[model samples]
Target: MAVVQADGRLWMTFGPYWTGIRMVELDPGTGKAVEDAPVHHLATRPDEPYAVEGPEIVEHGRHSYRFASYDACCAGVNSTYKIKAGRSASVTGPYVDGDGTPMPEGGGDLLLAGHGEYVGTGGRSVFKDRGSDWLAYHYYDAEDEGTPKIGLNRLK
Candidate 1:
């Protein structure tokens, strides 16, 4: 689980079925999490069934919070895998996409994915730099065929 601290509050993301990622807000005043707070569903589909996993939350600018996760569409048989992101002005949001669509039922641009050369890419670790951000993950080395190797790159 990855956590993001903002405005003296802690935010956590988790998935019960590995299909939908949800966020919970913690109240520092009571030292307990607010259960009734709305949980934001990470991904939703209208056609093919998909799962959202490996959720990471980060505080971007001063007031914006970004949420990231790996989306796996079509579980079996060469499933399409990619990293996606969404952001909100508050820690616990109604996160919106690049086009201002709500993430619970909204879709965003593909941050990273396989490009024919790489088989598939998912599982992401997002971290902050001096003032930038980076993403680290494992990908199947094309040269090695089926060998999985770690890959790291600046997210900018």
Candidate 2:
């Protein structure tokens, strides 16, 4: 979940702790942490278990996006993870979802969720290619006896 970034927007994928997700500017040539670059703390869940992870930042036109996964995952048929998203005008942000609630305040727009045999759809990556955005992630397929399946969806 390491995102290769320029424009001083380095998105680091983080995990079970959720708070571990950080945004820092890096030196592209050396792939090392840049000096004087402040690390911005991203996501957290105080009420439930800290299940958020897999952070990605994508710049689309005039807006910047923050993507994450929420809830439990990797439990096959029992996985409860789902994909969530937020957007900001700035790279290092106080991101707000579609409803305008702040991300650090447990706010995110639900992008993907479990349905029928598709259980726990999470672990996501986003990329912009050829003027189109693509969302890729993994989900548990109960129809196939809870096997892991890759899902690719075109996004706006």
Candidate 3:
């Protein structure tokens, strides 16, 4: 995922699920990672051996929040995917949850999860509209024969 920070720097997070995910600075003009940019771990699934996916970064107030999908995905109602998050003061961070546990060491605040007719609530993206922040994502609708459906929530 990519985010344009308040200071106009472009940042991105990416990596293989089985290995790990990390953040890197990008040159806005060149659309490429800055040479020799330091890579910082975005997160690894809490209590699991693999890293999370679908990373999203958003800046709010004095902190930058990173969101990622954990568990599994694309299995319709059987999917175990859920969204988790962490925040940091620096864009390239040692992000931590509300309890102050570091993200790279398997710590994140539970943000969204499967509930009721919705299963696998993940693949989230955050955007601003009309001066307000909004979150958009997809979920498997169990009541609708496990069809994937879009969901949105206003970030407060």
Best by TM-score: 3
lDDT of 2 by residue, 55-134 (tens): 88777777778888888889999999998888888777777888898777888899999999889998888877788889
Q: After superposing candidate 2, which stretches have Cα over 4 Å from the reference?
A: 4-20
- The candidate maximizing lDDT is 3
Model 2: how far residue 75 lies from native, Å: 0.4
Query: The CA-based lDDT of model 2 is what?
Result: 0.78
Clash count for candidate 2 is 0
Q: Candidate 1's error at 109, in angstroms? A: 1.9
RMSD of 3: 1.6
Clashes of each: 0, 0, 0
- Candidate 1 regions with alpha-carbon error over 4 angstroms: 17-19, 27-32, 35-42, 63-65, 70-79
Question: Clash pairs of candidate 3?
Answer: none
**Order of models, best lDDT first:** 3, 2, 1
Report how far off residue 82 is in candidate 1 (Å): 0.4
Report lDDT (CA) for all predictions. 0.65, 0.78, 0.84
Candidate 3 per-residue lDDT, tens place, 1-156, comes to 655554577888886776667888888888888999988887875566474887777889899888888888899999988888899998787789999998888889999999999899999999999999988989999999999999999987
Candidate 1 lDDT over 1-156, as tens digits, reads 566677877777777434566777877567466778766665453234456666677776754545454545333225466777777777666667789876667465678887655545767787777877878876666667557767788976
